[model samples]
Target: MPLLPALAVVLPLLLAAQTIEEQEWHLDALDVYSAQDQSRGDGVIVAVIDSGVDATHPDLAGRVLPGTGFGSSKGTDGTTDVDGHGTGMAGIIAANSRNGGALGIAPGAKILPIASADEKEQFALDVVAESIRWASDHGAKVINMSLGFSSSMTPSLVKAVNYAIEKDIVLVAATGNEGKEVSAPANIAGVIAVAGTNREGKPWKSSNVGTDTVLAAPAVSIVTTAPESVYSSGYAEMDGTSAASAIVSGVAALVRAKHPQMPAKDVVNALIKTAQDLADPGRDEATGFGMVNPMGALTAQFPPVARNPLLPEPKPSTTQPTPTLAAQQPVQPVVEMKDRLPFVAGVAGGTALMTGLLIALPAIRSRRREPVVSARDTPPTPW
Candidate 1:
């Protein structure tokens, strides 16, 4: 069966048992309830780089920070969502359920919305790149890019991703929904590429799979906040790698909140190293390391520093040297180059003589040997 159809069949049944407050099954699946008791991603800013977020959404409320717009509607603040996609993503990361609204994975995290695209789903790489820089510059610790383009890595986008990495920003992006290879900037190095999993913990049929995919999250039939203008109820059920990326972003926020001084690479490593293996025993193309475990990621002991297995370990010094004899020696007077000219000339002459002898010896040996003329060479001369 097609993936969307199967999701449609499973969603209604799941929705039947869930009330408005309990609609966020992903949080329960990831065991976020327990993790939240420790840290709710307080003092961390997560940038949602997608179609603008609806700041007025009940669940979002004051959690949405002032955002900049990079879409066709220039200079407009990023509080408007024409497609409801960005709002859904933001709610997944930081929605407050205290008012009987949808619950977020990291309710205490602030959402910094950077609108870079529109309802047409058009993503300009330049705009996305600018938004990433803006987010990193604006104190965002975690940047979630739920939107993706079919094109492979773009130079500008890659530069922006690297810039974020340099700024100690943890970047999370959705592996595209084409069910083929993962897309950029998710496929870009250092970006946490997230894949979608259904409620059964199996890989979502439509979620793209590739070596780039680094994490999995509950994405199918996810209930999240939507824009009231677009989605009348301010809630909707959606399925895609986008939701998975947001969930992982929220988990990143939680990890960051716990370890405020953790570097971006180590923060990402904590999540992947502690993830629960799914499709395969270890890391696989379908599910990367495995489904993200928010509780495990939060409490898991991560190395204080990043370690790359591919890099050769530094060789330990085999011997300890005594104190430098030069330290105790008297300072020597500087010698003038003119005074050492004769010595330098002698060394240069010796080197030249040795080089000439080395070159002549081989030639002398060749001259001593008798040269044999080939029959073909003689015939060609005669011809």
Candidate 2:
């Protein structure tokens, strides 16, 4: 099946009359307005690698930069969207408040649209790899991959991803909508894998979950731009991890714009550290670190890291500094209780109840562990 079909498109009228604030619930959920006060992603180029993006759309008119198309999409530039998926993803990242239409998380960010697949979705893995390389070379600071494959990563794609990372490009991708293992590209190391969350901040039922997931964002009923042919209003409600990934990509753009001096590694660190924890607390497979908090990501204070945490640690060198007496001693791992306090408290309470049960066992022998029900135990009849 075409992965593009994974997203469900609602009626155009649903967004035709809705106000900007009313239509884009994700903005309020992530406190995008407050976050924008700090940075609107200006000077950041976010490349949307998917189907084509409709540049003519009111919300994305001038925000879309000239982009290229591959495979069957080569007939036109990456400006015409045959499938509305790319348009939706682009709007989520950089749509402006034109015609009172949908608003994006980083309205000032420019979208570098790369059409990897046409309407048939016949694009190969090599095409995706080529697109990544193109985006990296073309001044794209952040690349939004709202598409994925069920197959394993190709060698060429892996090299392309590494190339982008080496160039300090922030890669973000959706964790897929199959409710299975995270799809390739997103599952690849060093990529910010985004999962889906509903308006209530709970995990979206259809969102794929895995240890690779990096963050969750609003995916259900997300209002974004679409091709005019797809929706007369030039907008529609979308549902999938595709939208979630785009939302996180927008936040990454904001971070890049706000801290132009910050390296890609630090940008990734800031986003992961500032997210709001959800579900099982502290980096669970369902929600990763948690929902991507724009305000926190934009304004929160945190230490800078030496490297991207998503990538594997480098091997230790043979030559090492002479160990001091304190260094020779084993360093105790510091444990933060706030994350697991609830589970720890629950376990303690359960232990106390078990002890009480053991103490009362001798006195309660008269009662059966399981309630007995016999044919004679029928309810009493009315007079």
Candidate 3:
């Protein structure tokens, strides 16, 4: 099967555990247990954009908020997960395990389901864009997109993403499960692209890789809620980057809940900066910034204000004076060494002449009287 087709059929594997024992290992890996003590994604709404959600699932009872549907299932009511994929994704995000099912990363968060795909499990880019805009406009703080296309990013999707960002919505998408490049919507800017990792903190063989990937989450043999029709039992084990994206979305909900006033950009930066490094010291194409750490992202202190990269930087003041060519040139001082040299030479010559005259006058004054008497006596003796 081709990669995308294979992804469409990636179904859940039934585990023998009669009662859903909490998938504590994956939660521990994300540090979700510790984070819950601080904030369990309370009062936060996460929009799940996928093949609808099982609104009546046991674990998801009363947690799913009313959401609109697009595509073949067109309406403002009744978001049902016939394919079972959206229900599984929602379970990973906000399933209430207290009722005897698997625990979600943020059990306190509420899910807003938007069915963008049809019964055939086909997603149209235009429908996906419409769903995103609807979710943002309808009080969704975090939007989880576990579905994507292998095709390039379309302008409609980009416009919807911009709309969400403008509304301070945190968007997260799954890097495709094709073992190749990340899928569109995830490839779009301002989306938190998530990859999949195993229990050993290594990249899942099937999870896609690309520069846009921002974090990794448990994706191998993961236990989550399943649709009753798909699995008579209410829970099943699944693996894919889709599950990973949902987990990261849950973490985003926790961050948003803890810091209610935080901007969407800082929420992303907190998750990226605090993720545990795996495979590489920093961010890598395979695992992005490494596995997502829920506790770290929630507890980590971030700067209150951050600049939006999409906006232009502030320009310098126009009233500031501009320097002319002459003002710009460096100034050099001139010195007249030739004029000072003659004055220095004359002072030395005068000092030397005064010393010589003083010595000759002292000798001549002492010998003058004796020399005149000797000359007169010599002349008398000769006569």
Please, what is the whole-model Cα lDDT of each candidate in the order they appear?
0.71, 0.74, 0.70
| lDDT by residue (tens digit), candidate 1, 1-383 | 99999999987666554455576677777788899998899999999987788888777887999888886745877888876678888988998874456788899999998877644434566678899999999999999988665554556677777678778898998886667787767777678889888899999887788988899998776777777675456666666788899999999999899889888878888888889999658889989999999888888886566432111234345585432222222222432322211000000111112211101011100001111212221111100
Clashing pairs in 1: none
User: Alpha-carbon error at 118 in model 1, in Å?
Assistant: 4.1
Name the better of 2 and 3 by lDDT. Answer: 2
Which should have the higher lDDT, number 1 or number 2? 2
Give one digit per residue, the lDDT tens place, for model 2 in 1-383.
45544333333344334565357788988889999999999999999987778888877868999899887776566988765668888888998866566688899999999998644543456678889999999999999987666556666677788888889999998887667777667877788999998888999987878998999998877777767676554655666788899999999999999999999989999899988999766898988999999988888877888777887665465798643222322222322322111000000111112211101011000001111112322212211
Show model 1 residue runs off by greater than 4 Å. 1-17, 118-121, 307-383
Query: How far is 9's C-alpha from truth in model 1 (Å)?
Result: 15
| TM-score of structure candidate 1 | 0.76
Candidate with the larger lDDT of 1 and 3: 1
Could you give the candidate ranking by lDDT, starting with the highest? 2, 1, 3
Instruction: List the candidate 2 regions with Cα displacement exceeding 4 Å.
Output: 1-17, 317-383
The C-alpha RMSD in Å for every predicted model, in order, reads 26.5, 19.5, 41.3
The number of clashing residue pairs in each candidate reads 0, 0, 0
